[model samples]
Target: MMQRTISTTKHWIVIVLMSVLGCGLLIQGGYMQAKAHFAQFLIERAFEQTLVDNQPHKPWSWADTHPVAKMRVLQQQTDGFQPLGSDLYVLAGASGRNLAFGPGLMLGGAGLGEQGNTIIAGHRDSHFMRLQYVKLGDIIELYSTEGERVLYQITATEVVHETDMKVLAPTAEKHLTLITCYPFDQLSGNAEYRYIVEAKPIDAQPLYS
Candidate 1:
């Protein structure tokens, strides 16, 4: 009958709509899960790479997974804190992730505590994502491969635009800057602002190479 045909058509349309919505949700969940996993992987790697070996070497590559550097005498919450060497800190996003969002290479500056400001950058999802949890006076540590250890303390935190160059400038006294995505809880994946952690160098060792 004509009535039966119309009912069947409506049922099919409803089924198709449900299917489409389900598919969309699945895709979105997958993307968010992937971002979270990548973030976790980054922190763990930093811990193993910098904590276990504090001093990082020149021309250090993310591909080079071995102990290219080492750190000594960590400060702050040493257990959870993964101190980046001055080598990788200056290089600036060497791991295909713009911890700094610029074209410059990662960790290009010298690795030490005597510099003006050892600026370090990492990706929000792939590196330094835990920076969101950091508080004032949090300790930062670094160790070198040639038997050197350095320590820093978080003095303050700030949020700035991506193009703000003052965040990376050198200061009159030795300092360390940790930068990552601002509003770390954003779900839209748009990095609008940057979180800056200002710290001062407490320990320094002369270059032994």
Candidate 2:
């Protein structure tokens, strides 16, 4: 009888510990979701101001990154073209910290809507999640702070090792390369592979033209 009582007590203790752990996980998840939404709101406001003045605007006073461009994807619909999702504000500098808020323009890449390959990187589960559903021939539209809009058609999508730097190489012709970790459904962080989406301008003319 005593052994059974002791076992019962231990089981209750285990259950209580698990309950606490589950609640903690839920709280952390809620906090992260709230932060993500709030950050996007601030980023959107800063992007709008940048568009109005044609200057970079920091999403927050202490943020190290600023809005550089606004990007959105479009897919063909029965009626006409429709946005795949809401616009994502592209930040400057593809540092990991900067990418937490939105996609970041990688260094050594061409300027937005410029003649060389422009590279952007984002977290797979966050801002770039829509990329997984994108297919060849979809349209990627980028709006620069200078009031210029460029349309790029998705030409290729491939998965490559994370160490492969070829994707970041400058292209002779204008193109856009988007990078995100592969296997979006993975529960682990820091995947070894990367998913790349290559796009080219629909028109060869200068952006301002």
Candidate 3:
């Protein structure tokens, strides 16, 4: 009888432990989701302030990066280029942490809307997911903090190995190079290939209200 009672107690203990672990995981997931949503809100507000002041603004007080530009993808319509997605704030550094929040500008690249190649990188599954649907000749608009808007026409899209650095080399004319991991629908992480979207500056103008 004692042995049977001990076995029953052991089963109950295991069930209780598993229940605690499951709840802990649930709470952790909820916290992460909340943080992600809140972070985007802060980033958007900071980007707006940066545009107004023409200065860099951290999305959060402890953030190591700041908003440098805003980006929007557009599709050609009968009425002209229509927005395909909401504006995304491009962060200054292309670090893993910064990419988690939004696209990141590759350091040492051309300044936004300036000469040379302005490169930006983002996660394939997140901010740059729309790139997969972007066709050649689609429009990409980049807005600098100073309110200058540069329009780029998509020229090409290609897949390259992660080690292929030639796509990121400097260019003589103004260009935009967007990089994300390929293939877009992969179920696993740490993809070894990269998807490149190449664009050339076609127009520039001051953003108006």
Against the true structure, whose lDDT is highest?
2
- Global local distance difference test of model 1: 0.55
Question: Mind sharing the TM-score for model 1?
Answer: 0.55
lDDT of each residue in 42-75, candidate 1, tens digit only: 5335535554456443232443433322222122
Cα lDDT of model 3 by residue, 13-36, tens digit: 999999999999778756754665
Would you list the rank order by TM-score, best first? 2, 3, 1
Question: In terms of TM-score, how similar is model 3 to the real structure?
Answer: 0.80
Model 2 RMSD, rounded to 1 decimal: 3.6
Backbone clash count, each prediction separately: 20, 0, 0
Considering lDDT, where higher is better, how would the candidates rank from best to worst?
A: 2, 3, 1
Off by over 4 Å in 2: 1-19, 204-209
Instruction: Give the root-mean-square deviation of each candidate in angstroms.
Output: 8.1, 3.6, 4.9
For model 3 the local lDDT of residue 91 reads: 88
Among these predictions, the greatest TM-score belongs to: 2
Q: Tell me the deviation in Å of residue 147 in model 1.
A: 3.4
What overall lDDT goes with each candidate model?
0.55, 0.86, 0.85
Select the stronger candidate by TM-score from 2 and 3: 2
